[model samples]
Target chain A: MTMTFDQPKTRTENQTRTGATVEFRGLQRSFGNVRALAGLNLTVGRGELVALLGPSGCGKTTALRVVAGFEQPDAGEVLVDGQDITRVPAHRRDAGMVFQSYSLFPHLSALDNVAFGLRMRGVGRAERRARAGELLDLVGLPDQADRYPHQLSGGQQQRIALARALALRPRVLLLDEPLSALDARVRLSLRDEIRRLQQELGITTLFVTHDQEEALSLADRVAVMNAGRLEQCAPPAQLYARPATAFVAEFVGVMSRIPARADGATVHVLGRTLPIDGDPAHGDVDVLLRPESIEVVAAADGSAQVLGAAFLGAITRLSVRSAAGTTVKVDVPSPAATTLPVGSHVELALPDRPVLVAPRKEQARA
Target chain B: MARLAMAVTALRGRIRWSRGVVLLIAGTYFLLPMVCSVVFSIDVPGQGVTFDAYTGILGADGFLDSLTLTLELAAATVVSVLLLLVPALITVRLTAPRLRWVIEVVCSLPLVVPAIALVAGIGTVLRWGPDHLADTPLYDTFIAIQDPDFPVVLVLAYTLMALPLAYRTLDGGLAAIDLKVLVEAARACGANWPRAVLQVVLPNLRGALLNTAFLTLALVLGEYTVAAILGYRPFAVWIVGIGGSQAEMSVAVSVIGLLVTWVLLLALATAGRPRSARTKTTAETS
Candidate 1:
């Protein structure tokens, strides 16, 4: 009967007890002509949740599989807690993995399914069942243990998969797109559940997902991969705020490509010369400005017009075509939704700080 | 209301007629022969609804022996094929992919060589083995295809025919399984490869195994050419012994063969039912 979602500490820190560290040195994999992973190097510190975020076939899953030992890298080593485990078989590596399908043994009751790994280890029936019972309780489903896997909802099945993985108390946890199968609300709630559990157990977990919002919301750091290469690896906030490459900027979060020409000390934008971040590589430049950095004011005394408006619940995304015929997307609070109409003149404001800029050729389509 | 109801009734009549036409043709083609067999099995020419055909076959001196031998051969083919195909498939995939391909080619070689070729070639070799096996009546009597010894050579030959189908079906089953789940789950629990294969791999494939076994059974039972050429007697060859006059006997064997196939289909259905708990229990318990 207790409502716990509003509590400050309920979501992030109760379960991540003692996290483990994972290190990969020069991991390489290839499939025919496709170079899936080439000399990839990454280190995940203890108690940190790092998301290997990339589009499909970007070598993120390959890296996760290699760590799980489901795949053997063509070269390089995988080390967990300073132990070389490149050759260690997946099951012997002491890492718990939760698959996207929630691959629970469909024929076993939830309780017995959770206890399967322990039973295989020859743990006596009484002790294993007791431990399994405790895990089911922890995931908030003690009553459903007797039900078969098919009898549970998608969310419940996922919780059982997690409990089964945790049953063995593995050092490093591997989650392969674990919540990509759920409905939006279920996904949000389960993500919070995962964040909470990781905090409590402090288990060193490697999560692989194609979702950028998921990576930003959950991980300590996000590693972006493109065509089997790691483009950038840093804290989520830092990576989102200051992406190392044009790919990182476009892939990590939303941004708009605004045309600008570098004119020595100043750049030409907004039909007026303005200054932005970095020294250019000469020629025409393209500056990447975040939508949050742009503001709309009434025009005539205005510099822009609202070309289109879209309602997004709490926010309204406005498509504004500037005086120079450049289109930009601006997100504003939903309360301003009715006030901003198409063809209405509006003035665009820029923040005082430096904005991310690159050459038109260097800027990714955003 | 009257017009709508009349229209609906006419529409229903049209629907039934369209459905009935296809059923009528199919039923006449397949069931007429089957109905005739039942009628023949019990008819007494002048007398109505009699069991003379049944008694006549049972009363015939060697008919029981031939029937018994046919059943024996079917059982043998099921057993031998199981012994050969399952292990062969297991090792084939477990080996290198290249080597597995070679084994696959070898298993399928029988298809290229006809059963008659196998019988002719082996029959010739056996005839030349130190002494001509055909010189003894044992060779001649065993060739009576429904004799107990018919399936020895019969099943062995059918194994070749049955193997490709069995291997392919089983291979499909093995491919469909989440092998990683089984192997990793077992390994984490500390079970080794053989144990994992037995407990995990084989059970999931029970449906395919049973299906192949049944198909193999039917094939061995009905096999005529190889048994005839090799001078052995299977049910098909034995039924041919009545020289087209004992159409009733032939009909009887066909009916039994059909029933066996159905039994096997049921077995296959049973095998596929989810038993992950009990299966795991028995696997661990033993």
Candidate 2:
């Protein structure tokens, strides 16, 4: 059967397909002395894709596990569709999970692996087989139904895993670094396909990953976490542009710390003043600038000297040392790095966009 | 070129000598006893070559009885060991992984305990059993242990002795697959513990199960010490008793037993191989 993914309307316009709302309230989990989730509270809106993004050991996965009913929280409740399901067994929770390792049953063919959940639910064999075939077609792997896991490629295995997870038509989907195990090229294409499918189904999904770019690209809302707590939760653009805390700003993207002085809502950095979100005490602080915001020009009388340059396809990242002996990274187009090679003097300039600032550290002895 | 040819010839000569020596030793070790027994059993010197002893087994009174009893014992041992082991190992591996060392130690204790020593210990235990269960339903079981028609004690003893080999085979199979992941996946698909074990775990372990069963069968067929001491005439004990009055018949039975065990082992080796290995060539042709 050929399954067509022809949902051309935006996810918001396709609001006719309703999805469940999932909420984790004050979830606390600990393994011995290490706290996995310290009072983590977050809610996923109906038909929205929320990503829990963090470094390893930041409890992003633990939060997803609690929602999936694989783990029990020590002092909290998980509510799905506004009803508490904290005590529900994993099999009864009606949540489908796609693990990082594919986790396909090796002995079963792809069709059987996809049909497994329906079989367990007591669906007729013919009906389950038809449904599984439709799911495989949906993932663009219709002909791979008869192939075993070992007979398929890594990418094919992951697609089969995803199809299996969606076969049950679960109310909520949980993905734990599903694309991290693949190569770079496959990872990109598969992630886009996943986003399209998730939107088509309109299932409220919680994807956990340490890759910031993936979280930003696939999630409707990205929740950056650190130390078992959410640092910020917002749309990708907002989380990248206007991070609520220093940790969120640093984790979401690359940021360069430059000495600056804060005067009310404006901060002065690199011999220029820029606007910030809120009014802070008029004192010395460190300004955080995105590499794209910093411009570099080669000039003999410049105060900064280029220390190194790395050509990264469209943009070249340059490491420069300021007159005060502090290192700052700036990204420029490829052609610009050729003229401003290593040891070349260059002037650093900031754009009009706002920059984040934190308290300045004590100067290191030069 | 001449020197190189001489060196090559020397290497070939050395390889041939070693291969011939090994072949001769192995051929003698395996075939010598069968050859001697065949010759000895058939040679009724004054009566010339005859098949008397081989034919005598058919007319022997207890031959069929002992053989049937041993077959029954083998079946019981295979089933009881599987029922006792498969679930316990799966549970221990999946749920209480910390108890793995203890299970391994207990299963392997039979290997260290000699068969004669085990029989002596079992005799003492059975002697104490009657007095303790004199007024209970268990008294009937103690009495049934002495039955010669279908001895249950031999089954119990064979099952215990087969534990170490069965455990190793099953553990090897379990190690080959990601048991925890498979079981958890089954559970997530809405399977209960029993359903998961029966349908998911056991089917994947077909090879291990067959290997353990056949190994237990072979062990039951060949064991003699405990049955002889218990005054039970199992196949092994029966063959020895026949030897007292009819030496040639005993050798004939021994040859049959050896052939039976070889067939079982051969079947075990091929049973668990991947199905694709057999069908790939056919698919290629089609």
Candidate 3:
């Protein structure tokens, strides 16, 4: 998707097809005893914004660093525009990166910081400054050009950092938790701004973030990683609904695991027999269900009692305990949730969607 | 209530008085020796307060040569020490951070080894080099380093002596800013490692670099034991050597040397401050 913002027409015209495809083929890295990337193979299409989402120490940042050439994979190759750049030094890679910390050169003003790459490339002083000024305007901080990094607010520093990263018109933009240092309001706004700029520039970007909402909202695809491996790589809605593994289901969104007995193609969960989503698990298993998928009805003789209710704007999450001692969370419309207060008994029902099941042992560990 | 208020006021006044007394004592303690030195340098037996000792400083034999040699040694020491430590410290910080303690221990080793002992070891090596390397081409290296015109061995010794201070100041500067992030950012901006260190790292470490240079300059200017023991008549040794025949001249030169060191330190301090900070200071002062 290409977007045209209020930026100077000439500059936008110059960036028409700037993005390059990035592919990580069997990338493997290890730090002493701990493996960071275990034979990781993934590809980001041209102009795609793929977010590497995982918990801390899960190697999301390591994978992004490998692509940016800050790190060399132990055994695999990283290709940009189908050219292997696995051994290229970071300076020659032409991959622009925004760091989690405030990486703006504190000694330089915002304009100079943005123009640093142009200067390194031997661009003339006047042209570099003019281009930097335009980039500052793009990030909505044109007036802050003369201000040093220490003088600007944290959010403004990040905006300049973003402009600086974009100044090179790099093949791929690597965002390593760029908004993680900002507060919630700034993070939300910058997240949108990054997405808008990425779309406008059509730059292929690999954003590493542990924030599930940020990944789901901004990414064309979210690659969920766990323990040095990609759990699942899919679109936001698909990854949310049809998570390939139990780890992906739990990591991507809120999921509740309840004991179930699977036989053949169906699983009997919460007094309802439903078709299994993936490979059928026989005998005892745990079924994973989204809170919104399970419907709760206020019933006097229901087997489950509403343990607690959390008002979440449009929907209220009700934590209910069953007679069989399994706690399940169900999301109901706030207005209806008022009728099912804590201590009130409710009957739960599932729609016709196939439910994913994991072995009971894994559920116990989770 | 009035009595209690009076008591508190009296207590505050007593504290202020004590602070004043402490300041006066410290000021006298530091200033009295310098004041006596200046007085002794100027006072003559019959001419009352003659300025001849100060005036004769420029025309004194071996004065300018020794001072120039000391400055050259200082410049070479500063360059050698910074060149050696900056890259080593940065590399240690960036890659093998766990080996940081190793650098620290090595740098700090010079501080514990007495100057006399260090000089003894160097003397032994210098003496041994001539005998062992007499037949080899290295025989000239021993003679070349011992050149009284500009002893390179002194620069080597000064570099070793300045390591601990240089390491601390640079390490402190590195700690104040995130070195890894800055270098990575510079690299991402298309700056190679050398460019990154030269432009980004060094600029941010301006204060620390100046401080390290000043300390090294001071050590070279004031050092007497190593140069004296090694039979080199640098500025400090010359000042001490003339004490028997020209006591007032020696004291005058010492006083002038102290003043020069202070001026250089002040100049460096002013230069090291950020332009914005200097402007702010000027505005506040004005």
Q: Find the candidate with the highest TM-score and give its number.
A: 3
lDDT of 1 by residue, A1-366 (tens): 122222323223335445678998999999879889998899999988999999999999999888877788999989888899998766577777788865776556789878877776677888888778877877788887787776689999888888888777778888889899899998998898888888777788899999999999999999998888889999998998889888988787778777777776577766565665656445587778777777777665576788888888998889887665677888888887677788888887676666777768542222
C-alpha TM-score for every candidate: 0.79, 0.90, 0.94
Write candidate 2's Cα lDDT for B1-286 as tens digits.
9999999999999999999999999999999988998898889779889998888887897999989999999999999999999888998998788899998999999999999999999999889999998999999998897788888988889989999999999999999888886776676676667777777788788889999999899888889999999889888889989899888889988877888788877877787765544444553454
For candidate 3, report its TM-score. Answer: 0.94
lDDT of 3 by residue, B1-286 (tens): 9999999999999999999999999999989999999999999788899999999999999999999999999999999999999899999999999999999999999999988999999999999889998999999999999999999999999999989889999899889998999999999999999999999999998999999999999999999999999999899999999998999999999999989988998999899986556444443454
DockQ of 1: 0.24
- Model 2 stretches astray by more than 4 angstroms: A5-18, A279-284, A361-366, B1-28, B38-58, B279-286
Q: Candidate 2: deviation at residue B164, Å?
A: 2.1
**Model 3 misplaced stretches (Cα beyond 4 Å):** A1-16, A362-366, B1-15, B279-286
Please rank every candidate by DockQ, starting with the best: 3, 2, 1
Q: TM-score for the second chain in candidate 1?
A: 0.75
Flag regions of model 1 displaced more than 4 Å: A1-18, A106-109, A125-130, A143-153, A260-284, A301-305, A322-326, A337-339, A362-366, B1-76, B79-114, B121-153, B171-197, B234-261, B267-286
Deviation in angstroms for B201 in model 3?
A: 1.0
Better of 1 and 3 by lDDT: 3
Higher DockQ: candidate 2 or 3? Answer: 3
Query: How would the docking of model 1 be graded?
Result: acceptable
Question: Which pairs clash inside model 3?
Answer: none
